[model samples]
Target: MLKKQVSSAIIIVLCLFLFPTIISANTNEQLELYSEAAILIDAQSGQVLYEKNSQEKLPPASITKIATAIYAIENGNLDDIVTVSENARNAEGTKVYLEAGEQVPLLKLVQGLLINSGNDAGVAIAEHLSGSVDEFVVDFNRYLEEVIGVENTHFTNPHGLYDPDHVTTAEDMAKITQYAMKNETFREIFSTKELPWDGETWDTTLINHHVMVRDGSYEGVTGGKNGFVTEAGFTLVTTANQENISLIAVTMKTMYDNQVYEDTTKLFNYGFQHYETDTIDMNSQFVDSEDNQYKTVENIYYTKKIGEIVEEDVTTSGKLVIKGEDGRKLVEKKLELVTNKEKEKQQIKNETIYQTDDNREQHLRIIIPISLIISFLIAAFFFKQTRKI
Candidate 1:
């Protein structure tokens, strides 16, 4: 019985050694996200707060208008009056009821497209800006991928109508929305809940289609767009500002409309309650303990919890690395010494970092020798102690 008890104790100790409990900072317990894909990001800092299958490509529906609106505002002359073609008038799905040959300002079309979720306005703007839908699609995709720096999104239409190949991820949509929210014009149009419309066929007050933004059920929402089709389900993109921090949330492929909003709200609440965006002024000089002055290549933002402190240091190679509490890198920038010195005078404890495979060899060169010396010292100490014994 004594032997059996000892063996059980030994087995329990081994199990405890093999498995350790892990604690995560995600306070909402990963959040019960209902949408198939969801992502929340800091608008100013572009830091990801929470994500659920964020990179999975899914149909974006009308949130694609966010991209279209920004593109039109930047590329097309918004003041130019564009003559509506028959193709625009005939555009399927939601529309502003623009009549064929009706002249409308490019800016007005963009407003109509975003406010009323007007498919016709999208087509009109697309045709006016690029001369044809096919050509517009090529340019739009390029802008989404190249200009905005999103990789998974591939849009075939400006209006986000169902095309088998027209798909974007929730993460990509959030990034696109973040980029659009930077422009004052796009922000105004996006946030406009109600606008008086004087169109050839439809003369009424155009209201934002997103129920949450239009009805004011959710506070702090600056602007939002929601969409749905049989193929894509329900997709929603919302931008909100609270406590001076801007947040963007995107949810896609939800079977029910309410589920999408629920997921978005959860994401936003989790982000706002836990994290805040802060920036490092590259213009400011950083002085080390040894009095070496350094400056960053550019200003950069990072998101962290209210109480968590992020660490930053300049490497020997003049690289600035910012890391979270878990030692995960948030961003890196090149650093320049104010004195134009060729060498770094001090190395922090972070020099032992092996964050990436590419740096494994470099870190190993530093770690292996130190480990060997420590082991040799320990062995020598034990030998002396044994001899004394």
Candidate 2:
């Protein structure tokens, strides 16, 4: 009977240890539904929470404008006036009706492009920045490679209208949108529900293509781009925040617009509902220590919370390894918490100096005398010349 009881207790403990990991693994595996590609990401930390075929290449419709807008904002001055060229004014599909030779502020062009899905505005910005649409597209691709680090994305134009060669992965788009959101101006423009420009109001009304913005289901639904071409099917990117947690959801190749919204909503809901960020205390060390050896070091806090960890029961402890002059470990200290809150507090000790051993002191003494002798010789030479004169 005693042996059976012990065996039962051991089995229960083992099950408890393994159950959460199994559940989390299953949750990640079960995220796929009615889309060629999708990803849910934590906006603050840029951690991928869930993904399905996220790296598969697909046309990115108007979503390509995210990168276009980022490049323009970083490289081009917003106040600089961009002249509308015949090429930009007549570029096909969803135009702001810009006329050739009409000058508009670059800022307004950005607003128009993002708010109204204006293809003309995209071309205008591209041409104004790089002198030609084709040249600008080349620079745009380079920006993706260099600045954004998007390996799987290529752009043929500033506007994301379907061309066979222009494509990006769902994962790449999430990364691009995540980076774009870091810019305050980009976030402002993206989250703007409505804006008036050029005596016409570009409003995201009930009839707007993005159903997520139209229906107020998600409370802090900031802003996102929607796209569809015959080739790409329905694709949507959505950003939302709740109680300081922000999430970005991407879905591609859905059968219908509603399905795109539904899939993205599911992504956001899952992230907000199930996932949360818990701050873990990493090793805190002293900075600017005057005496590295003494305990009387004034505390100068150097603390970093480890990035997002999903499991609840996983507790972390830190070990400090102090190195000698030869880069060998001299002492190892493991931090023990007096209180639970102390783990959260990043208290560091500073103004400490290591006590010099006889070898170190001898080396310093020898170097100082040599330096003094060299200085005296230099001074004597100068003084002797002065006396002779």
Candidate 3:
């Protein structure tokens, strides 16, 4: 039992000391980015692969429509015909040019909002769904915070016009796009290159504003959105998939039109070149020196640099801490105790017998010596007593 206790304590200490800190960068090389705020992340694991001022809040411009589109898809009835209002007709910036009182499906407006960067379409969708732009913005912010897990975003309008309060961070926008891309309807709309527009005033093709998606600039470009305002600079969000790994890159407040794209490409190349996903299967079991079995309850995927060593530390309380090559923690999971009923029972019986045998040997060593010592002491005591008498 003493040996067993010492072994368990050593195991715990080794686990804690093996990886003292988390490794953030897989490589020492850094990408020079022109954007004020930028981030690249593994879409599946939500692990930040690279970042520069990712939490800096700036104008998101038309990329705000990405949030608007997904919110509409989830909350509004896409098939319902929305009657265009005067407010929607006169909405400023790029537009699909909807005439007042024209009947169009909510889904079509969403398509136009994303594909064309149509501010008018954004206004129409907002008004139709929430009855007013102000109310729609309230719900939009709520969804961004509570549903999408973005904290630094605040929207004053659905169209991403230059309102002082309308702003978001590159990381937050990336998170929003990541969540939106999960929906089938939103993904279809986000990646569309062009669609036929049959509006009363604008009867032409609505082409995607994102050059990367339209031109296939990259091999696996799935969807992208770019935005601009005098205050927000140039903001871009792009997602690409290669070799089964999906990545999201968001850049904000780049001074030049092309800088956002350049920063995005640099980030993407860095992630694809250096990082990889390692999956931990839930059913995989570990056998310790004592033959104790342990398994996780669910599967987890971790992103690490290529050729990095991944290690696992299982504690006595059943917590499994996973570390990357740089001694950074990648994931922690609670392991479940697995029992092989017959095998465990037999092992317990064997352990009990072994302990009993050891105890008997210990008793022989201790009892014999103590009995002889007692006999000597009693003989000495009686001799002393007789002399005194």
Local accuracy of candidate 1 as per-residue lDDT tens digits, 47-159: 88889999998888888899999999999999999999999999999999999999999999999999999999999999999999999999998888889999998899999
CA shift of 366, model 3, Å:
39
Taking the tens digit of each residue's C-alpha lDDT, what string does model 2 give over 328-369? 332343444334433233332121223346567889999999
TM-score winner, 2 or 3: 3
TM-score of each: 0.80, 0.68, 0.77
Output the number of the TM-score-best candidate.
Answer: 1
Candidate 3: list runs displaced more than 4 Å: 1-26, 281-298, 315-319, 333-389
How displaced is residue 213 in candidate 3, in Å?
0.6
In candidate 3 the C-alpha lDDT for residue 47 amounts to 86
